[model samples]
Target: MNKIFETPLYPYTHHPDEDAETPVRHKTIVVGAGPVGLAVAIDLAQQGVPVVVLDENDKVSFGSRAICFSKRTLEIADRLGIGQKLVDRGVVWNLGKVFKGDEKVYEFNLLPEQGHKRPAFINLQQYYFEDDLVARVRELQEQGAPIELRGGCKVTEIDDCGDYVALEIETPDDTYDIEAEWLIACDGAGSPIRSMMGLDFVGRVFEDNFLIADVIMHADFPTERWFWFDPPFNPGQSALLHKQPDGVWRIDLQLGWDIDKAEEKKPENVIPRLKQMLGEDAKFELEWVSIYTFQCRRMEKFRHGRVLFAGDAAHQVSPFGARGANSGIQDAENLAWKLALVLEDKAPDSLLDSYSDERVHGADENILNSTRSTDFITPKSQISRTFRDAALALAGKAEFARPLVNSGRLSVPCAYDGSTLNGPDTDALPARTRVGAPAVDTPLGQGWLLDRLGGRFQLLTVDADAPDRLDVGGIEVERVAVSAAGNETLRERYLGDAASGVYLLRPDQHVAARWTSFDETAVRAAVAKATGRDK
Candidate 1:
C-alpha cells in the first residue's frame, strides 16, 4: 500500500494462497527500522523467511547519528548487494591524525593491502545511508520478498510466549495485534521493548556532555580525521573534525559538566566555539547542533525467550570509537542467518540462544574498549588528566608511542569462541585450525572472498576429492585447495605461511573448524557444533 513501491524497480505481485486467510503472521517481526533493523530484515528476506519491520517514524531520522562504517560492516553490506552504492557515495578515508595543542602527536595510514575487496573505512552521513537502505527494502518488497515495512506503527506492548511473541502496535490509523515466531528489538537506547521485558541495562554515564554540530564549511583541513586535545581554542576540552559528504563536516566539542545544559545548546554559545576552532577567516554555516550525554552500557542478556535485542536497544557505548552503531549492525548480521535457519527447520530453535551469548560477549568487549578510549580522551580526575597529558606529550616525541596516539581502537569483527554454541579447537588435524571470523581476501575465483563464503554453512576443504574422508552432512561444503605456498599477502595477513590446509566457514563467514588431512569425522563434528546441531 506504500506509494514508494510503484516505481519500475519495485515489483510487487501478491501470491494468493488458499490458506491466506489463516491469521497473518510472519516468521520474524523486527522492531525499529534503523540501519541495524533493516539489515536484519534484509538478510532474513534474502534467506527466504518472511519479515515485517515496524517503526514509529515514517522516514529516516534527520540527525547525523553515525558516520563511520568499518570494513566488516562493508562486507555485510556487500553480502546484502548494496556495497557498491555505498562505495560510490561515501568518502573513503584511510588515514587519521591526532594533535595536542597544535602539535601533531601521531598519524596512521590505514591502507591495508590492494587485494582487499573494500576499503578500511567510509565516511557518509547516517541519514543518507539509511535512506538508501530503505529504498532497497522497498525494491525487495516489490519483488514479492516476504519483507514488509510498516511506518508510523509504534509497538506499545509485547507478550513473550516462549515459543513465539505477540505485539500490540498503535499506528496513526488503527491499532492492531501482530504475531511472529520470533521478535528482534532494534529500537534505540530507550527501547520500549526492552523495558517491557523487564531487562536491566546497567552502565556508567559520563558527567561531561558534547555539543555535536554538522556544518557546511570551506577549510584547508585534510580529509582524514582530526582530533585535538586541549587545543588553545577549546582549552580543558576535546574537539574532533571529520569530513562528511557534500563538503560538510561533523564537529564535536566537549562541554565540561559545569555548563548549564539548557543554555549551552544556543547557537549564540555554539557558533563562537566554531569560529574560534575554524578561525575568523573560515566561512561556514551551521547545519545542526545539539547537546548529548554519553553512556557506556549493555543489556545483561541480548535475548529474552523468543525476543532478541539489536543495536542501541541491546547496548549503548560512548561514541568515542564510533562503535555504537557499527557494533549494532554486526549484531544484526550475526543473528539474522541463525534465525533464518531456525525458521526453515534447518537448525533447532536452541540455535537462537547463541545469539544472546555471542553478541553480549562482543558488546561487553566493545563497552570496555570504548570506555577506555573515552577515559583516555576525557580524563575526569586531576591525576588522570595529568597522566593523559603526559602520555600525549610523550607520544608526540617517541616513535614507539605513536600507536597509542593513533589509538588503534576501531571496531573489529568478534568471534564466538567462549559461547555455549562454539567448541574448542582440538588438536586432531595436523594443519587445520578453526577459530575466529574468516579473513577475507581475493581468492582463486574471480568473485568476492566473502561472496564465496557467505549465505550457508560452508566447509572449505584443502582437498575436494576427499569427500569420502569427510562426513559433512546437513551443511554445504566448498572445497578449495590452497597451494602449500599460499598467496603471499594472505599468508602474511592470516596464517604466517600458506601451508595451512582447509577451513570450515560458518554462515556468518566466521571460521568454524579446519583440518589439514580432510578428516571427515572432525570436519563433520565441527560443523555440527558450529551450527548448534552436534547434539
Candidate 2:
C-alpha cells in the first residue's frame, strides 16, 4: 500500500510504470489547470480523495487578468494554507481615489477600523496569485495528496452519466477516455466543457471594446487606484491606472464603439494613447497590450448530472468591479469542500446539488453588481450618462455627497440569505444572530470570527466553564477564554458590549449560528445543518 501510494498521482492507477494501465476509475477529474481547477484539486486531495487535473496549456500564463483580491478571497486562501505567502508578496491596497474629470469626487479608506489583521483588499497580478496556488498544490502533491496534473491535455467531450462522467481528453500524444465519479469544469468563458454539457451562457456583451496594457514606469505614482471618467485623451471614455509590484502599472482605455480592432493592437497606436495618459515625463515602456470585449453572463446551471461548472466556465462578469476572477476563485473554494465531502461519502450525493444552488446565487449576485457598475461607468444612453455625470458632480461636493459616494457598494461581501441549505434562524436575541453580518470579533482573536478563525469547524462558547453544556457530535467545539481583557476587547469590536456568548463556525469559516449561552440542542442542529447531516 505504501509503495503504491508513494507517488502522489500513483494511487489512482494500477502501477507507476509509464506503460502501466490507467485506472478504471477516479474519484474526480477536474478540467482546466487555472486557479479554480487547482483549488478544487487541493481541497479534495487534502481530504484523501483522488483527483486528476488536466490543462491545455503546458505552463502557467503570464499577464495580470484580475488585479484585486478581496478580504474574502484572502480568507479562502488562508483556509488553503497559502494566505500568508500571498499577503507577503502582494501589495496591500486600502485606499482608492475616484476621479470625475480633473476633480477627485471621492476617496475611500477600505479599512474602516484598526486591529484587523487583514486589509480589505490586496493588489496582485493574477499570474503571481496562481503561481502561489500552484506551488501549494505541488507541495500537497508531495505530501501524498492524490492530485495529478496532465499538461497539454484538454477535455473534448463529457458524458455525464448518473454515477460517473466519461471524459474524452485530447493530448499531444493521443486521445484517450478517462472515467471519474464526478467532473468539474473550470475552463474559461470559451469553455468546451460547458458547450458539451449544453448549458446556456445567457447574458449580453458590451458593445464597447477596451484596451489593456501593463507598463513598466520610471515615474512615481501614489500606490492607489486611480479612475478617470471622461478624460481628455478619450473624451466620454473611462481610463484606469492601478499600481502593480516592481514599478509596473496596469492601464485601461475605453476605445469607444467604433475603433478598428486591427489598428488598436499596434504598439504605435497604443503607445501614443498611453503616452497621452501618463505624460511624456513618465518614461514608461509597454509590457503587453491587448484589446478585448467584456460581457456579463451566468450559466443556466452550475451542475449537469455528475459534472459541475466553476470559475469562468460558470459565469462571466464585467471587469469594472474586479469581480470576475475573484468570484470564480470563491466558487472554487465553495465547491471544493462539498466535492470532497461527497467523494468521501461523509455527506450524501444530495450535498452536490447545493453546490449549484449556492454558487448560482453567488454568480447571479456578482453579475448583477458587475452590470450595475458597468452601467454607472459606461452609461449606455445619453440619459444614463447625464445621470452619472450629475451624480459625479454631486459627489464633488463634500457635504451633499460624502455618504452616498462612500457607500463602498462595490466592496460589499455577499450574503447567502436565500440559500436552500441555510437553516432557519432560531436565536432568541438579535445580538446572537450570525446571519446578514459576519461573526463579531472577540479579544481572543480578530474582528469577525469569520475572518480570523481558522482550521475546521469551531463551536465557540462564551461560558468557559460550561463545557458540560456543549454537545460533541460530528463537529469540533472549542471553549475560548473570552474572560481576559484582550479577548474582551476583540469581542467588543465585533459583538459590541451588549453581545456575548457562544458561536458556531462552519468549515468555510462563516458563522453558522450563535447563542447568548451554551445550548447543546441548538448547537447540534446548527452543526448538523452546516455539515449537511440534516435531511
Candidate 3:
C-alpha cells in the first residue's frame, strides 16, 4: 500500500564543533532548506562558494503546496542544473480554461510559441521539488563541493558585523554559534529570521479565507488548469482545480470571511464539499487540507548589511499568479551570482544593494498583480462584483473584456524596467527580449540557448565569430557562435536580420549589453555597471 504521508525529506546530519571554543565559520550560511534556500545554496556551491543550509524540519513540505513552477523559473532551475529532474517529475501544463457556471468563457493558452524547451508551467508537489534540489546538493557534496545541509536546526539569533554576519543556531540537543561572511534567509512567510530582525511586511491583505486541499485519486480529469468564478459546485465563491504529480489533485475553494478554519478543514466538513464538486460516487482519499488567508506583502529591503533575504523571506504574493515561489527562486538566481562575486572580492559589496533594488521591483510587480487578481476574484464591494460579473459575462462573447477577466493573471517573468544594472538596448530587438530581460531560450542545434549561457559570463556572437575572449577583472568568458540556419530563433531574438550582433550575457543569464560588432571598452563598462560599480 502507498504511504499515507509524504516522506521526510532531509534527515538530520551531525556537524562537529570547530576546535572546542571557536565557532565554525562559513563563507555563506543559508537558513531554511526549502526550494528557495536549496537553489541559492546549489548556485553558490556550483560557483565554488561553501554554504551551510539550516532548516528546522527534516520533512518535505507536508502537503501539495506550490504546485505550479513557471517557465522562467524552470529556466532558472536549468541554470542550477536541476531543471530536467524537476520537469521529469512534474505534470506539464499550458492550457487553462476559465468557466462561469460551466459555461466556458474562452480557453486561454499560456505558451503559444512552439519549439521552446519547457511548457508554461509544471505542477509538482513542493515536497518533490525540494527533494530533487536536496538530491542535487548531495550530488554536489559527493563531487566535493562545499555545500552542507543540517536539518532540524533553528536559528536563534543573528548579529550583523560590518563585514560578516554571525548566527546562533539550536538543534534539538544543544546550541551552537556559527558565523558567515554572508547570510541568506529563505525562510517562509512567517520567517523567523525576518521576525528576529523586526522587519515589517507592508502591503494589502484581502479580507477573505481560502481553503486548499490535496486529493489523492486516479481521476479522469484532463491535465490542465481549470479555474471557476462562482462555480455552481460551490456557488458565490471562486475555486481552482489543478492536476499534480503522484496521482494527486489540488483543489482550492474560497470560503468567505468569518468562518472557523479549524472546523472547515475537518474531513467531516471538507469531504462533503469534495463530494459536492466531484459528485457522490467519486472515490478519493484526502491527502491534505488547510485553510489560508494570504496577504500580498514584502520587506522594504531585501538586503540588510551582510544578511540577505530570498524567496518567501523577501516577498510574498497570492498563489493566484504563481508568483511566490517562482519569484523567490528568481531572487536566488539574481542574488547568488552577485553574492559570489562580492565574496570573491571580484566586485564591490555595493553590488549587493542592487539585489535589494532589483528584487523590490520584482516584488512590487508581483504584489501589484496579486492585488489586482484578488480584487477581481473577490471584489471588495457589490459595485466591484457587478463590474467583474459584467466583464466576465462579456468575456464569454466578446474579445476585449477577456483581458479584464482576471481570474488570475498567471505568472510571467518580471522585466527589470529601471534597474541600475540594466544595459542599453542595441538596435531594435525583435524577439521581445531586451537587455534588462532574462535571456529568452532559443534553439541552438538540438540544445537550447539558455543551456550555454548560465553559470558564467558569455559573449554570444550571432552569425559572427572570433572576438578575442572578452575578459574583464579576472572574469574569463566563453564565446558561442550561432549560425543563422541552426539558430533561427536566436537570429530573430538577438540579431533581427542584422548581419551580426554581440550579446554580453551575465552569469545569471540576463543580457548585459549588445553591439553590432565587438567593442571591448563598451563591454567592460557594461560589466562594471552590471556589477554595481557605476553608481
Q: In what order do the candidates fall by TM-score, top score first?
A: 3, 1, 2
* Cα lDDT, all candidates: 0.76, 0.71, 0.86
| Candidate 3 Cα lDDT to native | 0.86
Name the candidate, 1 or 3, with the larger TM-score value: 3
Q: For model 3, how many clashes?
A: 0
lDDT of 1 by residue, 1-535 (tens): 1222222321222222112444356688899888999999998988888898888777676667798888888888888778888888898888888888888888876765677788888988877778778888877888888898777678898898777797877765556676789999999999999888888788988888989988887767778988888888899888888998877799998888778876887888888988998887778887767888878999888878888899999999887777987899889888998998787776888888888888888998898888888888778789988888888888878977665652427777676666665544534433223475444655544555566668776656442335522335544665544442445644544344334546677777877766544566777777778768877
Q: What's the TM-score of every candidate structure?
A: 0.91, 0.89, 0.97
Q: Write the per-residue lDDT of candidate 2 for residues 76-178, one digit (tens) a residue.
A: 7876877788888888888888887777888877777765556788888776777787788889878887888776676787787788888776665666777
Report the C-alpha lDDT of model 3 over 137-220, residue by residue, as the tens digit: 889999999998988789999988887888888887688888888999998888998988888798877789999989988899
Predicted structure with the largest TM-score when compared to the true one: 3
Worst 10 residues of 2 by lDDT: 1-10
